[model samples]
Target: MTQPILVIKDMSIVFSSPDEADIEAVRQVDLTLTPGKTLALVGESGCGKSVTARAVLRLLDRNANIPRGSILFQPEGEAATDIARLKQDSLPLRAIRGNQISMIFQEPMSSLSPVHTIGDQIDEMMILHEGLRPKQARERTVALLDQVGIPGARQRADAYPFELSGGLRQRAMIAMALACTPQLLIADEPTTALDVTTQAQILDLLRQLQSDFGMAMLFITHDLGVVAEIADEVAVMYLGDVVEQGSVYDVFARPSHPYTQALMSSIPKMARKAERVRLSPIKGTVPAPKDRPVGCAFTSRCPYAFEPCATIRPERTEVGGGHHARCHLLTRQPVEAVA
Candidate 1:
């Protein structure tokens, strides 16, 4: 759509260890993000959400591997570049890492330096990318702190990660990520481990700031409720593959995949005294990435599965209006839909 700001084409990622067979962390996944829009990648742990996000930034650990993929980044004024092809720690990639693209990791407490003050931490990125002197960086850091709703910006900037509450630390992380005004932000569950109220506040802050900065976001989260609250588009992953992708409204209101239907039914909803709604949990666990089925990886857990589901991987088929699902059931139209 509109020559997406970021387009991932047939991307795959793997993790290899000397003693073990290669584990496919990500399959032939494809995703796109237009400018100023948010795409939520939601799935259970090991569904390759984080790995895919990390691949965009070239931030995976040493053991991780990518046999093939192309992450085409089309920053406004520049020619499109394949971030997946660029060397991870090279100069060009480095410039894009925190300059054009920044990330707010899941655990600021662990990701943030234990040795530095919050102000210094935020200042580092600006200094590195914007070439700001200490004084200017500090001044802007204070401003960003205030903008992100961290009270007493001046004094709190001097505090350490341990000194601030979980929420405040997350705010500081956001401030730091915004220091360079990146074109895209990959937020790896930034609200994880926070209270519900705090999560809502952080989500609100993220939406406000993303709008203000006009940056695309790849929001990796497992909470469908949160997806409804913030996402414009959503990609549902299972066992290293994206089984469904579409507008949040379309996907949530009319889920096509059996996996997606099961996921939707599991969302806890509010009900009155006479309207008790029991959650329909999916039947089985996700298969191990290293030894998943050659066919639809979801067949082991899918309820409407048929013979082909166990032998051939279903290609993505359109349900309606840009909504697609990779389930064989999509072929048997009037047969049976998940209850």
Candidate 2:
């Protein structure tokens, strides 16, 4: 197997202060991202999709508790380091954060500083990491803006986040993410709020940038359409657990888990101008973190669930080459493959 840029093994996360009960948000998620490839982490809201990405950057709230697991990250030319064990905001982790692995947040307007020019923000990373002088950093910043498809890069660098259009602000965000040419990029729903046309443009730009930089990307989103467009591998999450994972072609063409099947079916397919289209919504709501089912977290919502599915926790088992799913239904005959 090729060495993965990141290896998240049996990772679990909880949120709890001294007085409150623990809210388990992520449960033993294991994911891998090979160099220069895009791994899509797909799931609906509250499925720990965003939380998993935040955990990698150690950007969780103060109450976050990671009791088990290791986020082993192998920088392009360095030995692997376990990020889970690193102290938050420590010098080493700080250097790794934007220098070795950077992230593009979901909301560019919120992530970018309203008080500073976009150039100032993007320049800060290179200045801090590479010790480039102010003039040199500014030049690099303008070049980055141009690289991410921002028009009038030099002038745009002086603009504030609120001053730019949504797509432009997102382009600025991508520019910041690629400023250091990090080994891994974690993009958390970076195109959620944009129009379809703008979203397509941003996706295309990201694909081009990722290829040019040769950086591994952990793409987090609930949109299967986006997954189909950009992902090399797909991990389907349900109620804080990754229930199914495989190559994008395999997972979309042959979803092996009940939850994955339902999600794939939920994707909206275009119809002829005259034909009416409908999405097959998933049957039940996601269980609350505090009230998750004891056996399989998705058992309550799984249609093909059996007595064992409701009584015993299903373990992840390999269904095919590099494909695995957590479901008791797989223990018997194979689940029906969806198109």
Candidate 3:
């Protein structure tokens, strides 16, 4: 079996409040991303998808803390570094963050610097990480922009973030992310803001780049359609905990968790006129972190939730062929049987 490029084990994130008790945003969660594969973290807003991705690079805010778990990143031919344990500003982390790992944030308009030209921003990464001279870095930056399908790459390199269209700005961000040929790329809803056409182009660009570079990717999105289009593996998150995970095919074919089922049902599907039905939106919204339930985080919204689901947390139960879901339904033994 191929070794995973990144492994997250029992990871949890918390935030300290001055007057209130600490808010635990993420619970014990486990995930693995093999080299050259994409793992999509799917959930609604505030489900901790972005927080988990940010944790990989130690990019959380000052008040955020990792109370438990380890984020192990092992680039080929290098020793594994525990990102959770590394000091935020340590030299080792600084060297690895942009060199071996890179991220494409959701909003490029705000993420990219307005003062600096796109060329300068990308060139700086090479100059800092690859130790390339200014001329060499600039040449490489132009090549990267061209490689990502940017027209008039050399001229666009001098353009400010505000000067380009949303699609072009996103392309520039992708160019910057690929400047160093990072081993791992974390894309947090990179296509959410773009129109359908531009979104498809970005997705294709990412696929081509991943094929060329053989980079592992952690893709964060709430779109199941995108997951079907891009991801090899899928992990369904509710509140903070992962409720179901497996190869995209397996999970989509047989979603065991009620929450996962609800999400799958919510997708707009085509049907004959006579067979068409209304979309089934899940009942209720995701509770705030402090209001999360004691047992299953999804119990409140799950239509199939029963007595034990409200009091006894279910462990991850194997479905088949490496598929697993955290729900009492999969356990086979009913509440009456246990009682």
Candidate 4:
């Protein structure tokens, strides 16, 4: 098997309050992304999906602390580098951020500067990351816009972000992300604010770009439908921990974690018939980071939870090749019990 391009081992993030209380936003999360594959992080709000994504790029806020773990990036044909230990002033990451690992945010309107022309914005990245001359960068920027399926690339490149439609803005964002031929792309809810048609278009575009560049992708999303469309592997998170992870087909077909089952069942299906296919909403909201439960965070919502689940946290154990889940039920009882 090919070696992974990015490897995150036992990564954790904490936020220190003014009162000196620590809020753990992420706990012992491990993930790997190989070239030409995509891993989707799926969960509800406050499940630490976004925090995990931010940690990969070292984009966390001021109060956030990475107390332990390593984010190792092995650039193509290069030695492994620890991104977590790199200093802020160091130019080592400059080659990685836009040039090797690009990111597309949820809100393009907020991510893109309204004052700058689309072409100029993309050219800025090319200049900084690739050191292309101004004229050369502008030429490549227009081609990138066209490559992303933007209509009237020459004219549209001159328009400010505010002057473009939502779909166009998203395409522009994709153009910027692909400007430097990155080896990995982190997409944080890239289709959140768009309509259904536009969302489909953007996803299709991403898949095509992934194939064209053969770059690894870390796609963060809450929607299972979106996951079905893009992910090769799926990691289900709950309140800062990965509850279940496996190939997309196995996780969706036979979810071992109770939380994963609940999420899958909630998706509306047209073929299924019932008085009403009841959507199983997880009982309570995710616990606040400051007040995270000691044991399994999903114990309160898990139907199969027993005494052990409430006190002793479960270790991630392999149920099948590359399929793992964290739950006491997996340890104590037969896998049949949870299934």
List, residue by residue over 165-262, the lDDT tens digit for candidate 1: 99999999889889999988999998978999999999999999988999999999999998999999999999899999999999998998888888
* lDDT (Cα, tens digit) per residue for candidate 4, span 61-132: 988888998899983456788888776557877667777888899998766888999899999998987789
Can you list the residue pairs that collide in candidate 4?
none
**Candidate 1 backbone collisions, by pair:** none
Instruction: Assess every candidate by TM-score.
Output: 0.95, 0.94, 0.96, 0.95
Per-residue lDDT of candidate 2, residues 1-339 (tens digit): 567888999999999968768988999999998877999999989989988998998989999978999999883447668899999988879988878888887799766889999999999978888999999999999988998889999998999999999999999988887888898999999999899999999999999988899889999998999999999999999888999999999998889998989987787666633667677899979989888877899888878778887678798999999999998877877668998
Better of 3 and 4 by TM-score: 3
Q: Which pairs clash in the backbone of model 3?
A: none
Q: Which ten residues in a row have the lowest lDDT in candidate 4?
A: 330-339
Best by lDDT: 3
Question: In candidate 4, which residue ranges exceed 4 Å CA deviation?
Answer: 75-78, 273-275, 333-339
Put the candidates in TM-score order, highest first: 3, 4, 1, 2
Off by over 4 Å in 3: 75-78, 272-275, 334-339
lDDT order of candidates, top first: 3, 1, 2, 4
How much RMSD separates candidate 1 from the native structure? 3.0
Model 2: pairs clashing at backbone N, Cα or C within 3 Å: none
lDDT (Cα atoms) of all candidates against the true structure: 0.89, 0.89, 0.92, 0.89
lDDT value for model 4: 0.89
Model 3 over residues 79-144: C-alpha lDDT tens digits? 888989999799989988878889997799656899999999999999999999999999999999
lDDT for 328 (candidate 2): 86
